[model samples]
Every structure is written in C-alpha cells, then in structure tokens.
Target: MGVVNVTPDSFSDGGRWFEPEAAVEHGLRLLAEGADLLDVGGESTRPGAHRVSPDEERRRVLPVVADLVAAGAVVSVDTTRAAVAAEAVEAGAHVVNDVSGGLADPEMYRTVARTGAVYVAMHWRGPSDVMDGLARYDDVVAQVRDELAARVAEALGAGVAPEQLVLDPGLGFAKQGADNWPLLAHLDALTGLGRPVLVGASRKRFLGHLLADRDGVPAPPEGRDRATAAVSALAAAAGAWCVRVHDVPGSADAVRVAAAWRAARDVTTHGETSGAHHA
Candidate 1:
C-alpha cells in the first residue's frame, strides 16, 4: 500500500498533494512505483491535528479517488466520517481505512456495511487533538488486543462480513514512543483476531524518535526510509497481510525478501511435507 495525503496539514507530505490534480498525479506515480493499493486521506490525523468537516473532506478526496478509479487503481479512502466514506465508496473506493475505528462517528459502521467496501478498523481512543495525553496504559499489548477485538465485534454487529474487515493497530495514534515499540513487538496478537492485519508505521514520528541520536535530534521523515523498510520487513515476517507505507518500492522489496526468508525457514524447520506449518 502507498499513502496519498490530500490534506494541507498532514504530518508528512501534506501540502504537497492537497490539490486534487496533484493528488491524482501522486497516486498514479505510486502505482507505477509498485504500490498494490493507494490509500488517499483528506484530513490530517496526526497528533493535535484538527478535524475537517465531512463536506470538506469529500471535496478533498472524491475527485482524486474518481480519477484513480477511472485509471484502474485500487483505491482506499482514509477517513473517519460516514458521509465521506459513503461518497468515496460510491465514487469507486474499494476500501474504507478509518483511523478512528468507528469511535469518532456513530454512523461509520452502518455506512460501511451499506457500501459493502472492505473496512479497516484501526485502534484509536479519541480525536487527534488531545490523543497524546491518552497514551497511558499499564499493558499496551493487552489493551490494544482487547480494544481491537471489541471493534471487530462492533463491525460485525453493524453487518459487515467477517472477511470484509481488516484490523490496524494505529501505530502512532494515542501511543507514546515507549508504547509504540511494544505494540509492534506483538503485532501477531492483532492478526490473531482472525482478520488480516494492516501495519502503517511508515514515516511516523515514533520510528524517527527510535532512530534519533543522543542529541535527541529526530530524523526527518524523508530520511527515515531505511528504518521504515526495516520495520516493513519485520511486519511481513510476522505475517502482516499488508503494510501501509509511503515508499512503495522499498517496502515492496522488503516484503518480498521477508516472504522468501520465511519460505526458506519453513522448508528447513518444518520439513517440506509439513504443509500445516508452511504459512
């Protein structure tokens, strides 16, 4: 997956693609660069970011989605609003990647079910504005596991098919630097929810913080490609179905390497005849 932020204030590559034409061009470029799916978001969901109204979000995202769909791109709308999700689905978005996991809007689940689009329920506690302070947790892994499980139930209750849903751990949302690492360490727990897991840690603040020096200077988002690819390899090795990333070519290569390594390991440790353990 590749990320296309259509907001002027996204934490990374914000104003760069705020215009519909620019966003469409960027989406096409990513597709050419080996992105299996293009994720377009109208609003910025970074910590302390303000919300965009449904109408504004629609205006920011739909035109780009329409163009991408017309050009044969598999598009996913990154939104937390029901109205925006409905509109994007109608305009040819195949998936709804809601960062808020239906917590921000009561109508999100119903609207997703009505559209029958693949729904990605991400772990989130509240709006982005004050989420930094909400990062407190005694056991980050257990809390995230329990919260995502409940979201799966909520999505099912809203009439979405079990196979049509995907789970995301929301890498940086409401998670402190310390909490984020432990969550990544236990990604299989989220995958154990019986649905595919999507990991989106590319160009995020937490990854940059982890790679910082003793001077506490953070690596710029653009310069974090190597670190992002390292975690991309980790996520794929852990059986993540998809990884949302900005550097599509690098991530695609990492996943391929990880897949090959797992294949080779299975053949050696599980024996060639043990199909049960090959996955």
Candidate 2:
C-alpha cells in the first residue's frame, strides 16, 4: 500500500499532494512504482494535530478518491468519518483504513458493512491531539493485541463480515518511540487474531529516532525512507499482509526480496523433510 496524504500537516509530505490533481498524479506514480493500493487521507493524524471539519475532510478527500479510482487505481480512504468512508466507497474506493478503529465515528462499522468494502481497523487509544497522554501500557504488545481484538469484535457485531476485516497496529499514533518496536517484533500476535495484519511503519518518528544522528537529532521524514524500507522487508518476512508506505519503490523492492527469501526457506524446509523421510 502507498500513502497519499491530502492534508496540509501530515508530518510527512503534507501539502505536496494537498491538491486533487497532484494527489491523483502521485497516486499514479505510486501505482507505477508497484503500490498494490493507495491509502488517501485528508486529516493530519500527526501528534498534536487539530481536527478538520467533516465537510472540509470530505471536500479534501472525495475528489482525489474519485479521480484515482476512476483511473483504475485501487484506493482506500484513510478516514475515521463514516460519511467520508461511505462517500469514498460510493466513489469506488475498495477499502476504509480507519486509524481510530470505530472509536471516532459511531457509524463507521455500519457504513463499511453496508458498503461491503474492506475495513482496516487500527488499534487506537484516542484522538491524535490527546493520544500521547494515553500511551501508558503495562504490556504494549498484549494490550495492543487485546485492544485490536475488541475492536474486531465490535466491528463484527456491527455487521462487518469477518473476512472483510484487516488489522493494523497503529504505530506512532499513541505510542512512545519504544512502544512501536515491540509491536513490530510481535506482529505474529496481531496476525494470530485470524485477520490479515497491515503494518504502516513508513517514515514514522520511531524510525527517525532509531536512525538519529550522533548528536541525537532525529532524521527528517524524507530521510527515514531507507529505515521504512528496512521495516517493510522485516515486516513482510514476519507475515505482514501489507505495508503502507510513502516511498513505494524501495519498500516494493524490499518486500519482493522478502518474498523470494521466504520462498527459498520454504523450499529448503520441504527438501529437508523429504530427505528425512527417504532416510
């Protein structure tokens, strides 16, 4: 998956694609660079970011979603608003990537259920502005897995089919820098919940901090692409279903390497089993 932030403050390439035409062009570029799908979001969910009005979000997202889908690109609307998700689906979006799970909008699950579009429910504690305060977790991995499970249950109760659901471990949303590492390390716990896991660790602060300078200054977002690509390779090897990223080419290549490596490992394991049987 490729990211298309149609907001003016997404912490990454914000205003770069804020215009519909630019966003559509970027989406095409990402597709050409091997993005399986595009995740188009209007609101800036970065830490301390303010919320945009529902009308404003719709205005920002709908046209981009419509144009991209019309251009034969598979699109997911990265929104917490039910109205926006419904409209984007109406505009031909294939998925609803809700960072807030179902907490932000009461009607989101129903809208997804009604539309029959794929729903990606990310584990989130609160809104972006106050979420940093809610990052306390006794066991981050266990808590995240359990919380995601609860959200999955809620989505199921709201009429979303189990098979249409995907899970994301909302990296950096309410997490401290250290919190993200364990989640990435224990992705099997999330995938163990019987849903495909979508990992969105692209150019996030945690990666920047990990690759910080000797003076301890974090890397800028654009500078974090290599780290993001590394995470993409690791996550793909660890059974991730998809990795959302801003730089599609690097991650696209990384995942292909991981897939080939996995194939070789599987083949080797099968050969060993056959040798043991013949012996």
Candidate 3:
C-alpha cells in the first residue's frame, strides 16, 4: 500500500499532494513504482492536527480517487466521515481506510455496508487532537488486540462481511515512541485474531526517534524511509497482509525480500526437522 496524503497538514508529504491533480499523479507514480494499493487520505490525522469538514475532505479526495481509478489504479480512501466515504466509493475508491475504526461517526458502518467496499478498521482511541492523551494501555499489544477485537465485532454486527474487513494497529496514531516499537515487535498478536493485518508504519515520527542523531534529534520524515522500509520488511515477515508506505518501491522490494527469506527459512527448518526425526 502506498500513501497519498491530500491534505495540507499531514505530518509528512502534506502540501506536496494537496492538489487533486498532483495527488492523482502521485498515486499513478506510486503504482508504477510498485504499489499494489494506493491509500489517499484527505484529512490530516497527525497529532494535534485540526479536522477537515466532510465536504472539504470530499473535495480533496473524490476527484483524485476517480482519476486514479480511471487510470486503473486500485485506490482506498482514508476517511472517517460516512458521507465522504460514500462519495469516495461512488467515485471509484475500492476500499475505505477508516482510521477512526467506527468511533467518530455513527453512520460510517452502515455507509460502508451499503457500499460493500473493503473496510480497514484501524485501532484508534480518539481524534488526533486528543488521541495522545488516550494512549494509556496496561499492555499495549494486548490492549490493542482486545480493542481491535471489539471493533471487529462491531463491524460484523453492522453488516460488513468478516472477510471484507482488514485490521490495522494504527502504528503511530496515539502511540508514543516507546509504544510504537512494542506494537511492531508484537504484530503477530494482531494477526492472530483470524484477520489480515495492515501495518502503516511509513515515515512516522516514531521511526525518526528510533533513528535519532548524535545529539538525539529525530530525523525528519523524508529521512525516515529507510527505517520505515526496514519496519515494512519485518512486518511483512511477521505476516502483515499489507504495509502502507510513502516510498513504495523500497517497501515493495523489502516485502519481496522478506517473503523470499521466510520461504527459504521454512524450507530449511522443515528439512532439518525431517532429518533429525529420521536420525
């Protein structure tokens, strides 16, 4: 999955694609660069970022989505508003990547069900502005699993097919630097819930902190792609169904390498175990 932030304030690559034409171009470029899925988000969900009205979000993404889909790209609209989602689906988005996990809007689930588009139910505690305050978890991984389980249940009850949903732990949404690492390290915990997991750890602040400079200053967003690609490789190896990223080609290569390594390891381990049993 490749990220296309069509907002002016997303933590990274904000103003770069704020224009619909530019966003569509970027989405097409990502597809050419090996992105299997293009995720276009109109709202900025970065910490302390203000909200965009539903109409504004629609204005930002609908045209881009239509243009991309018309260009033969598989597009997912990253939105929390039911209205925006409905329009996006009508405009040719194949998936609705709701970072809100059905929390922000009472109408989202029904809207999603009616559209029958793929639903990405991400783990979210609150709006971006206040989410940082809601990150108190006894065991971050376990809590994320339990909370995500509940969201899954809700989505099922709302008429979304069990298979139509994908779960995302929401790498940096409300998590601190410390919290992000544990979640990534324990990604299988989320994958164990009988659902495909989508890990979006691209160019996030946590990676910057992880790659701190000599003076302890975090690297800028663009500088975090290498670490992000590393995370993508690890997550894919851990069984993530898809990893959202800004630099699609690098992550695309990383996942391929990870898949190949896992296949080889499994073959070797199986052969060794068979030899040991025969001996």
lDDT tens digits, residue span 44-90, model 1: 98889998887898889999999999999999999998989999999
Q: What is the C-alpha lDDT of each candidate?
A: 0.91, 0.95, 0.91
The estimated TM-scores of all candidates read: 0.95, 0.97, 0.96
User: Which regions of candidate 2 are displaced past 4 Å?
Assistant: 270-279
Instruction: Report the poorest 10 consecutive residues by lDDT, candidate 2.
Output: 264-273
Two-way TM-score contest, 2 vs 3, winner: 2
- Model 2 lDDT per residue over 18-134, tens place: 988999999999999999999999999999999999999999999999999889999999999999999999999999999999999999999999999999999999999899999
Query: Candidate 1 — which pairs collide?
Result: none
Highest lDDT against the true fold, candidate: 2
lDDT of 3 by residue, 1-279 (tens): 999989988788758989888898888899999999899998899899889887888888888999999999899999999999999899898999999999989899989889999999999999999989987877999999999999999988989888889999998888887898899899889989999999999988888988889999999999999888999999999999999999988899999999999998877876798999999
TM accuracy, model 2? 0.97
Residue pairs in candidate 3 whose N, alpha carbon or C atoms collide under 3 angstroms: none
Backbone clashes in each candidate structure, one number apiece?
0, 0, 0
lDDT of 2 at 112: 91
